[model samples]
Target chain A: MNKPLAAIAAFAGLVFLGSGAWMLAGHFRAQDAVLVEIVQDGKVLYTVDLASEEDRSIRIEGADSWNLVTVRGGEIFMEEAGCPDQTCVKMGVLRAENLPIVCLPNKLVIRFADSQEVS
Target chain B: MKLTTRRLTELALLTAAALIIFVIELRIPDLVPIPGVKLGLANIITVYAVFRYKPEETALIVLCRILLGSMFAGRPSAILYSAAGAALCLIGMLAVRRFIPPKWIWLCSVLGAIFHNTGQILAAMVLMKTAVIVSYIPVLLFTGCIAGAFTGLCAQMLVARIDRKPPA
Candidate 1:
């Protein structure tokens, strides 16, 4: 009801609503993504054109861990991960543009890249 | 400032309560697979301690909870992120404690949560040697705000109902 409380509430609401919208927008935009980039510790380890790739499993190994990145029918996901948390594995798929499949412990990331020429 | 018997006892009790919450929360399935998003239900005690106790005492309570909580959760590797977030959250909450009125406990908690997420991401960046972790900050911020509000409200109610004035 007061000024400070109202201001706090407005700020919180703006962040909550605005980011949610942005994330959702990103999700829809990713549906059109055809290039998936694999980066490790900030370097582009590999880039695959999802539209052209046949069903295959790529095993990515880091310092002391590994992630079995699988591509099936043009959809990419972390089918298996050696990290303790398995967060990236549980992430299911790389379907969102902004929300990358990040295995923090392994310094691994699978994200939708800009090249969208899916044939 | 003096660590009287009653004060020591209260701090211990609060730390124990927070550890319990932390352990219980560790059992809850992650709502999202995002690294930084969680209920963070244990933060309820930190928020309550920030308002009810002195800064020094609050720090002790948070330190004990984080250390013990990590042990109980069986994630020793998590101690770094948890400690960084708790330190930042405690400092920010203590600094802002003077301005925020009792009714805006949720706001204070929200700020704490933002700082917590920032610290976690920063730690990740340094430890992982990659800026890609920054991508999670927005989602963490948004989720942190909601979770903070819930825990803060719970703390606010608990603070109001149970009256224990600190010694002057």
Candidate 2:
């Protein structure tokens, strides 16, 4: 193999392995008793505990469309949306610390809130 | 560009193969809720095109593939994001092609990934009209590295195989 090719291959290998390890660590980490809030336009729209809430559904409407949000046993997700790309809905649920349940068209954010830790 | 029968056939075959891979990849269940994240198996064909074809020709192939692939997968709305990402990726890889030799194909792939993510974020920013979505940039960047490397390796193996064959 050519020297530059070999070097790139080595670098790729390192990146793949490193990311795999990072994901594994993230997957195994303990789940915290978190509070998730969906906010829009400076208003708190919906709030739920990620640990104790049962499976339920809610709908939020935008200027042009609406989104069906689901809350199952505390975890929140977008079940369906009327937006052009149902990307937020395709994203099943909010699980990771940094990953928020986001609806771009609606400007709605369902993420783990720091304020919930005390309550 | 003049389209010879032989080149046309080659393009069709490559398109068919890419579609097959795209369909097969769709069967794999998603592990995360993020809409953009995937193994990006179709990129294998893209990586090959970047090295083997002219920049314009490679772009045509990608555009056709992504358009048809999204239709086949029944995700019409996804075409925008895919188009944006593909456009950026194609530009970046084509530029890198000048500096990086075939040996460093993986570097080109990685750069393509970075550009792809940049394009997607740009779209998101425009559609959502806020910078808050920028938070996803780091995670996408991190994943881009891994996905780019895998696709690059696949392309490398493919180039080696093709090089071994005598030109017809």
User: What tens-digit string does per-residue lDDT give for candidate 2 at B1-168?
Assistant: 877898788878888888899999888776554757776888888888878876767787888899998888776656777889889989978865756776677777987887787788787666655555566766676788878878888987898678734222
Error of 1 at A17 (Å): 3.4
Model 2 is docked with a DockQ of 0.24
lDDT of 1 by residue, A30-107 (tens): 267789988887888888888888999989888868889899998989999875667788889787777888876667
* Regions of candidate 2 where Cα sits further than 4 Å from its true position: A1-56, A61-66, A72-75, A79-97, A103-109, A112-119, B164-168
List the lowest-lDDT window of 10 residues for candidate 2 chain B: B159-168
Best by lDDT: 1
Fraction of true contacts kept, per model? Answer: 0.48, 0.20
* Lowest-sum lDDT 10-residue window in model 1 chain B: B69-78
**Candidate 2 docking category?**
acceptable
Question: Chain A TM-score for model 2, please?
Answer: 0.69
Model 1 lDDT per residue over B1-168, tens place: 678898899899999999888888877888988876889998999999888888999999999998888777655667888889989999888877777777888888988888898899898888776776676777888888889889999988888887878435
Best-fitting candidate, scored by DockQ: 1
